[model samples]
Target: MEAQVINIMTYEVIGSKDKAVAVIAYGVKTPKKLAKNIMKTHKNIKSVLQKTGERTGVYRIHPCKLLAGNKNTEVIHKENGFSIKVDPQKVYFSVREAEERQHIANMVKSGEKILIMFSGANPFGIAIKKKHSDVYITSVEINPAAVAYANKNNKLNKINRVRNICADIRHAKLEKFDRIIMPLPETAISFLDAAYHFAKKGANIHVYTFNRSFNEAARDVADTCHMFNIKCHKVGEHKVLPYGPGIYKFRIDLKV
Candidate 1:
């Protein structure tokens, strides 16, 4: 007999394969029933979860309700030839940002000292190590849970040369780096001065932000640079994702 299927349009699969497939059925009126139906129809999916809250707090983790199959929330997410173990309920992990992480990694030159701010689960640092093995990276995150998972992921991926630090970037006594990455688009600009302070002369800083238009994104970067008295030139601007109806998450690469 064929198992029942839920409407694909009403839900999204957040992660998959060799583990439980996490699905968010926020738009579905009968989420639990839909989740159970998904688990019954999809053989590869061992579990189904409904997202319970918006991602919030310093860790950016969202609460989830298990509707079917196993109770485990921890799972291995394989991407870019690496295995990353993360518990969505404990720490933030976005499959959507995987490509953006790799893009940043591709921009790095060999032997550069790099700092990744808000390096959640070390995906950014690990992607860089996988692409460019010679570079030294310091991955800083405020959430202890994220830091632990990041270290675990680094070991799982056999990635070396990345130093994971669990502390607020503003309070961490960090050495100047050749390239600084600010990945938190919502508030990356607020930390621009800290990035400038920790960057060596002629360093490249990649700052991500959210704005309604490309012009506004560029202006935000330029205004932040002016506030820091740093000479900033836009190397490139990329629209990472559509944040809302008219707003977008953008990355503005700047040279100082």
Candidate 2:
């Protein structure tokens, strides 16, 4: 038996070994066929969803429609050494950022205070706490649902030091942090001033941005620092993922 490929399957799976859910990107031309293929290939994946629209607004969540099997979207996505109970429809998350989160975790030093902006389901916070139990973490997110999930995930991971703040980063009242992580690639650059506001001297801010090239990403960071009247240096740059055609999401580390 042979079946022609309707379109290249661009999808990601969430959950652990027992059961999982598949999410297909919005650009997939034949999502149903792709969902069928995903279900066939991954026996553990019991539910499939396809994106109905691009990620819009500040929430970074898009509408999703069930394409196959059960309609459940909530799943305990386990990675590294922690588990996060999240509903993809209710919050923004990316299984593809697993390694990126790990890298950010590895950058942390013990007994340091860290802040994460646009924390979503607090995946980066979990990753850091799992690796270094001595560090204190604070996560700020605007979406109430995501903040709820972030708290639940903290308890699920048995992590006790994370403080979840439900508000815009600009309005968040907090002390200075030794390190900061900004995962919102769409408009992270615009929030550099906020990051600087809560940053201690000699702090490192890991900012993720999408641009045509790494140089352009670094330039944007430099320009933002200049615009904010903050003294900073570009310490590192990393390609996190491919966002679109000829566009890459880069992590530009700013040392203040």
Candidate 3:
């Protein structure tokens, strides 16, 4: 008899010695025996969880159901020579965005203050600070759970100077930053006003948007800048990742 198809998740491994957590897509039928078979074949997977719904509420991560193995969703995800303790069930993280984070870190100059908005798990801060130790970094996020993990991740990497705050970034009083990074793709474009207020003259700002085309994403930023009365010229653009069929997450780099 032919075995039923098992949609083995391609989630990135979370720890050394090949430990991983797999999230089964919503509506996928994963039988118990099949889930066991997955663990047998993919020995590295420490657990299996099912995606239940879209990200909503304060958690801002996919609500998942534990299907097999350990119930603990927390794991230490190693990336770019640093480690991040995260729970996919509690906070949003893109395993594929490590390269993008590193690219952002590469542009940081020493002594420049950096602001990372929607800074979930403080991943971008880790990549940037680990690479450029002299620069000051501050992360503002809304979710308390993510902020807790962000603080732990900072200490996990022995990064002592980062300021992690748990509050809506719009209401947070902050100093102007020399470089600003907005990585929250789903709604980051809508927060350009916040970036504008936090930016220093001639400072760099990076915005990520999800749109049908790269041109549309770039145009959106230009229009937002015009509305905000800020002369944020586009200095760079990049296709960070594909959001869906014909939809992409693009990063637009600007100079204030």
Q: How many residue pairs clash in each candidate?
A: 0, 0, 0
Which ranges in model 1 have alpha carbons more than 4 Å from their true place? Answer: 1-16
Task: Report the lDDT tens digits of candidate 1 across residue range 1-75.
Answer: 111223444654544465656566454578777777777777767778777766677777777788888877777
For TM-score, the strongest prediction is 2
Reference-based lDDT, each prediction: 0.82, 0.88, 0.82
Q: What would you estimate as the lDDT of candidate 1?
A: 0.82
lDDT of 3 by residue, 1-256 (tens): 1111234343233443356676666666644665576678877678877777767765568887887998886877777678888888888876778889989998999888999999999999999989888889999999888999999998899987899998898899999999999988878888899999999999999999989987899899998888888877999999988766899999999999
The runs of at least 3 residues in candidate 2 whose Cα sits more than 4 Å from the true structure, single-residue gaps closed, are 1-9
Better of 1 and 2 by TM-score: 2
TM-score of 3: 0.91
lDDT of 2 by residue, 1-256 (tens): 0111223347778786667888887878888998898889877788999889889778898789999988877888878768988888899988778889889999999999999999998999999999999999999999999999999998898988899999999999999999999999989999999999999999999999999998899899898889999888989999998888999999999899
Candidate 1 residue-pair clash tally: 0
